[model samples]
Target: MRCGIQSFFFLTLGGAETLLLTSMAYDCYVAICRPLHCHVRMGRRLCVLMVTGSWVMGSINSCALSIPYCQFRAINHFFCDVPTMVTLACMDTRVYDYMVFLSTILFFVLPLFGIVCSYSQVLLVVYRMSSAEGRWKTYSTCSAHLTVVTFYYSPFTYTYLQL
Candidate 1:
């Protein structure tokens, strides 16, 4: 039961936070790459829908992941997570590990990819500008968010991939 709760918490919270970061990346992409269309393309309605969808996705994912850990089991690692829990399970966990990897790719890797692509485009756009000041000015907007992404995604990727 405790393991189940842990998986549930990780899935729900992790998914939401990951998706929120993805959304912010999209915001930066749209803002920098397509300023004119940003307002029209990403309105209040879309933002709300994206946020609601993230919560729904997180809950659904949590439910899916929690079911597998229904029975109590020992966790091998310091934390209660799918990877550690899988390692601790008596049953063969090769299949579960693959599933977790796939889910991690979906929940984590894809978002990181989107963030990379977003920043890449932002870079291209800034480079296309004539003045160095313009480039610096554009990059300044995203630097803070990018810093946060670096700190957040590095450990996350290490955690999932290392597991």
Candidate 2:
């Protein structure tokens, strides 16, 4: 069904977004907390692997849910959300709903939690620095990262969570 295919695309997009935010936070943590080893820890190969893994996970999650929704054609939301689209199906959607709910928790909520935790620890370390130069440098780096995270997340949260 067209709705199922659209749902797959949107779910993959959402999963990839969540993974990207999580990876960015992890990169920042290494850059700030272990600056000496950042180059070693976040090498090109590792970066590529992380990105590839995220896409693989996103694709798997998307396909797993979308495959079941082939019976449905209508989707209620302006955008494709698996649960919402599944609700429009004429057939039973309990299993599909459960899968979507689980995938959301794993791909979205858990990654967000990790990102928040990583940033909190990074901020705590920044706050404890005594020297003016150290403080300024740390603050500068953190402010940039925070600005980016806020810019990306605020609108998404406002649109999805509030709605």
The lDDT per prediction is 0.74, 0.68
lDDT string, candidate 2, 1-163, tens digits = 4554665676566666767777778888888888798878777886676567666655655543444444526554686665465556566767766765666566666877888998988888888887889878877877776787778777666654554
Candidate 1: stretches off by over 4 Å: 44-49, 52-78
Q: How far off is residue 31 in model 1, in Å?
A: 1.1
| Top-scoring candidate (TM-score) | 1
Q: In model 2, what lDDT does residue 154 have?
A: 77
Clashes of each: 0, 0
* lDDT by residue for model 1 (40-88), tens: 8778887787667566645544433434544666656665676666665
TM values, all candidates: 0.81, 0.75
lDDT, residue 91, candidate 2: 64
Error of 1 at 155 (Å): 0.8
Off by over 4 Å in 2: 61-76, 154-163
